[model samples]
Target: MDITRYNSEAWDREVESGNVWTKPVSPELVRKAKAGQWEILLTPAKPVPDDWFPKLEGLRVLCLASGGGQQGPILAAVGARVTVFDNSKKQLEQDIYVAERDQLDIRTVRGEMTNLAVFSDSSFDLIVHPVSNTFVADVLPVWKEAYRVLNPKGTLISGFDNPLLHIFDYEEYEKGILKVSYSIPYSDIESLPKDQLKKQLEAREPLEFGHTLEDQIKGQIDAGFIISGFYEDNSAGKEFLDRYINTFMATKAEKVYVDKCRDLA
Candidate 1:
């Protein structure tokens, strides 16, 4: 399957279906952001720590796989040079919409998360990536590419699903039932039975993968980023796992000068 093409189209359709992630922020939100009264979600509920970010004015920020007009427009309103790179054109359009409406300067690019060749080395000072990477099967390349594009001492704040979130019957989990089923590093492409996969494909639903912590956390270190901050969050009643363990985690990594990072260079 063409994962990129498939997921791209799936997300475009999601925008049409009014998926929450695809919704654009209101002009009022942008106004608030410009006034120093704003917050953006890196996880399900918790806003990213203000200290996790450097000063917004003049910062070059890439909203990686984040194009719903939620993060990029706000960052631009807060005085950052914001670029939103995402796979779905519809998702990018949402950012464009907010940019035009709020008269904010935000650039939108349509592309995959793993390959960021569209950007040059050290092109950005910060990257704000929400929980969109679960759509990709391989995540290490994401960290490596992110490291390549970020300036030294830059910050990368990312959110991703806990691998434990995947070890269950997905449908049952939505019903508030916990059924331990799938193994770690889950992949809808490889893990689902043929009949179920066929159903999902027929429905044109976006296929998802749950990457391991090694790929999520240690991958950043191998890519030369120093993990500086971390936090866990739940779905705020949207997920049953919220009642027990947090199903999502966000990290703040700083690009540092180190021999380990030079390996990637």
Candidate 2:
């Protein structure tokens, strides 16, 4: 299956069905953001640390795979030159909707997260990526592209699911049981049985992939970013796992500056 095309259509359906992530922020939130009072979430629950951001005025920011009209508009309202890139057109439209409604300037680009060739090298000073990469099969390329497009010392704040969450059976999980049914680095595409896959397809749910901690964390480091901050969070819907363990993680990292050397006399 063409994962990109399938997930795009699935998420467009999500937008039509009013998924919480597809909802745009209220005008009052934009108003406060314009006045320098704002907070955005990388994880489901906790807002990103203010210190993770540099001064917002006039900085170029890329909201990577985060075009749900949430972070991009707020950052634009706070004076950042914001561009939102996502695979889902409906998701991007939410950003456009918020931008037009709030009279803020925000650019929306529809594309896959792994391929960011539309952007030039060092094009952005910061990237705010929420918990969207679970849909992508490979995440390392996403990190590499993010590194390539970021300026020296550029900040990247991202949220992703803990691979551990994928280990439990979905049916058992609903009943507050934690029966292990899958391994880490899980993919719904490859792991699900025919019946379950058919059910997910019939329900119009986007497929998910669970990347290991090494790929999600060390991948950023290998991409030349310095991991600076980290936090763990629980899922928002009062899931069974939330009572025991946080199922999400957010990380703050920065591209390091490298100086070219010249031969001395």
Candidate 3:
């Protein structure tokens, strides 16, 4: 929504600049991200469904936005031959360190998520995309590429914020048993401070970049991956909202929640 912050120059600056969170292997930010307890908060309380689990042994997997290897490392621990990919070299390198620490066999690669033709078509058994890709407005390109790279019958295990959760403000306040400052999606707007921006890059912000459910399901179908399962954990969002304004609803203005048709393409 505040994509104005991510101009073409900003994206390129991230590449040329060597800042940890901004750049990827940003050593300082990586360690900080790993050390922070907030990540544990973001993790799903319940395990992902069995059907969503990719067959680990001999299955080639790709992890997008493998920030500090949260999901990637977990999947790797389960014996998946995983290759973690991200635009941030610093982040990937940090993940590499974590993988080494855990003694997990995980590979790291740096590249844009939307275009994965660098790898062969039908090359992977599964793809794990977490809270990333919503930053790129056109997620279809990424989904299309993922389909191109995965073999027929291959699975994709992806997770992101439920769009419905996006309609809240996170400023500090209390009102209801669940204090809510509901707003129309993308209305309660504020520019992220520089430090906050880096923090977000380090800990993937699903709400900031998640596509609507309709689009996500459509992406799976169009890309040829069977939509095996979907998961939603509102505990974290609700918890966060209770302390801050739940911006999903209007705080200053009357709001309307519109259900627009989402493109699966």
lDDT by candidate, in order shown: 0.92, 0.93, 0.53
TM-score of each: 0.96, 0.97, 0.61
Scored against the true structure, residue 144 in model 3 reaches a CA lDDT of 78
Which 10 consecutive residues of model 1 have the lowest summed lDDT? Answer: 256-265
**C-alpha root-mean-square deviation, each candidate:** 2.3, 1.6, 10.8
- Residue-level lDDT of model 2, residues 90-183, one tens digit each, is 9999999999999999999999999999999999999999999999999999999999999998999999999988888887888888889999
TM-score of 1: 0.96
Q: Of models 1 and 3, which has the larger lDDT? A: 1
How would you order the candidates by lDDT, starting with the best? 2, 1, 3
lDDT of 1 by residue, 61-135 (tens): 999999888999999999999999999999999999998898999999999999999999999999999998999
Better of 1 and 3 by TM-score: 1
Worst 10 residues of 3 by lDDT: 248-257
Off by over 4 Å in 3: 1-43, 169-207, 236-265
Give the count of colliding residue pairs in each prediction.
0, 0, 23
